[model samples]
Target: MVLPAVGDVDRMKRRIQSPDYRDWRKKVEDIYGCLHPVRLTGLWEIADKTSGEVLKSTSGHILAPCGNRRESVCPACSDRYAADAFHLLRAGLSGGSKGIPVEVADKPRLFVTLTAPSFGPVHNRRFTASGKQAPCRCGRYHHERDPLIGQPIDPDGYDYVRHVLWQAHSGKLWNRFTVALRRQLARAAGIPVREFADHARLSYAKVAEFQRRGVIHFHAVIRLDGPHGAVDATPSWGTTELLADAVRAAHAATHVTMKAFTIDGVPVRFTWGDQVDVRPIRAADAHQVEQADGTISDDRIASYVAKYATKGTGKSEAADRPIRSRAQIELLRTTEHHKQIMRTAWDLGAPVVCPDCHPDGPHRVDGCGCARIDHCATCDNGGYIPGPLDELNLRRWTHMLAFRGHFLSKSRAYSTTFKRLREDRQIWRFEQNLAELGVTADSVTVINHWDMTSVGHRSDEERELAAAIAERTRAARKHRYQTERTD
Candidate 1:
């Protein structure tokens, strides 16, 4: 590999030795360890918004956003995002952050998993009731890390069409399920569905995870709260058992009827798959004590959900990068099954000619012969209508296997929001910086005008140095935590 220039190295040393190096380093610390930092150049001023009196001003300087949420894209930013997710989930369960009342820990909380129905049989690791390894349907015992575990046994028989359609409408299905869950809860409590809102409320934070089979499943932390949300007490009828029952009933009953559209002259309807799993979340303090029936721990659930929040389909046989063209789709590094699904999406997204119009035939309008309109008799029903395939919007989400929904979502009452947490962090950092600078202010406003300058590392040597620094920082943090535990 080509080495870094000697002049560049000397300049870097001089910059590091500069009098303002410490301040500059602190300013860029947030993005210093990022694999790819979004560099920006701008002038900034801290002034009074009301009086327009400038308190502080800075000339043009380089800044980094460090806002990426994907670990594969930027490890530093993703680590921060995951930490925020952990706090958000843990606060909802333990109730020590974001102004959530501590009594929320006493509420009926559940760590539920809602899965996508199986489109077809795939290679899976099967276990007997006694926790013994069992042979898969294909007559072989698969390993825990088997690459073929999620691949279809019969690729040709796999339902790629419904799979993509289900992925596309997964968000809608979740919405319907939530509505049904509230109704189910009301019915179980012997109250009218309309009156359910007056008695209790449901709050949840969910993260979508892609199984090895390339299908998306939701892992959610669902909590039953009082009608006024975290502020009020839960009703007497709001028990963990009742919540579990409602979850099962809602998952079984919920379905979304896709808009009527023809796919090769046949109508298609979408619904959730048959597989659904729901489990109660124990108290955080008691999470370590496992139940006889293999119950999930609250801490484990929080960590699991948080971990997946920064992940993508790359863990499985799917592409993390967007597939914008036929060439990209064909060149995707995935299993044959995943490749086929991507191809189906691309094929569906391609524009098709109107079935009513024939290029070689004459128009029905008198002397109009308008070839543009498929139905010349009336412009109302003319031209090409989006078929079921086109309605899927496959091209926009081809990289996600046609899933267009966010990987992480939450109800309004589900603890604190990502935005709130980020804002709090920003305020804390600003305060710390002000203290370091020996500045005191009752109120201040920051005005910023930034333009994109550059992104990523300047050279492999710089990337290596940044990565080393990041690794060391992580190690130091880990060591400190261990030391605290030991102490």
Candidate 2:
């Protein structure tokens, strides 16, 4: 697309007709003769930095991204993200990428699921070990494909207020849980809590997800490592069995006590629900084993976690405001179990001052009503609820309060640090860049100049040229594909 440019062209025209134009015109002609036509080419040059000597250079066809989004949206970049994630997880688990040893997998490995306690009963797919389906509490024999599986089993008894509060505080609760878990592990191993660090370290990657009920649960890949991380050897006593036991003990012992809420002159305290499942990660066996009822290996775990990475609190009426509009909120509110949560969130957002909780500082991040993220101590408006918001669909996650974290996030020492992996990627990119420039050896030195400019679509003439080139390229590809197919 050619931009309409009158000023520059007009200035040049005026200069052409000036009184001293004859001499000036001769100089302009000389310069214009030297100007190169914009014949497109992929080109590069490299030179010795100090001596200004040419060392190496190379270039070839460059394919710019189309910026599409249809899964089709830049398949190159999307595949890159998926591949990187695969390598990242594979590196932490089996230690393949980089120099991480396979021995790391032999350490105390656990694929665990930690759930939110019940605020109220939400509808769930219920079946016995023999696959006998049970009736839903809603007094209906729901079908196998019922969409209400994650909704409140009993809407009136559900506690949406508590659920949202838990979501808000989920991060803090996880931190506390980790601390308690370390203590439990040390106690199980007969080591002092302080000495536990000396024996082994806890490495984990966890991803949080919102259930159909609109509450978050955590799926974590937890491992035990030596003090130095995956590279070091864990103590002799550190076994998967011991780790499993410790996890159970930790879960059983863990509790968070909030100030009592007075309901009709009675005080109430809330804690984690009784449902906790701690399992041992058995030795790796590729063989497929069938249970009495057929359920294949959990293939969707990665996709499940990946799905939540793009979700927002607004999806469950978990955010103060919907990301879209009030109409969207209305849709979510009218959904089976999200209405009560939406109403409660709106009601909570109305009052400037918290009824029970006080401001440790200004109630929001800057002028935005959202809480300040980095400097958290500045706000005491933790969004604590006086009573659990009774809404079954919103009940299970009463602990979270209303925020969600990414699944499979980790601290620096947990497995390999993301920083280190990123460094590896950077090194790989640099190597590719050098290779592209035809640099022969690692010892070779090179320098390159890059002239950055924004180029808009050219005039009709240029567009026609580009279209012709594209047509030729497509025809060439079709010919090549036909040849391959025949061969």
Model 2 bad stretches (over 4 Å): 1-82, 260-270, 288-328, 331-336, 349-401, 417-423, 440-487
| Candidate 1, 216-236: lDDT as tens digits | 888888999999888889999
TM-score of each: 0.85, 0.61
Ten residues in a row with the worst lDDT in model 2?
30-39
Instruction: Estimate candidate 2's alpha-carbon lDDT, on a 0 to 1 scale.
Output: 0.54
Alpha-carbon RMSD to native, per candidate? 5.1, 13.4
TM-score for candidate 1:
0.85
Displacement of residue 441 (Cα, Å) in model 1 is 3.6
Q: Name the 10 consecutive residues with the lowest summed lDDT in model 1.
A: 376-385
List per-prediction Cα lDDT, in the order shown: 0.77, 0.54
Per-residue lDDT value at 435 in model 1: 75
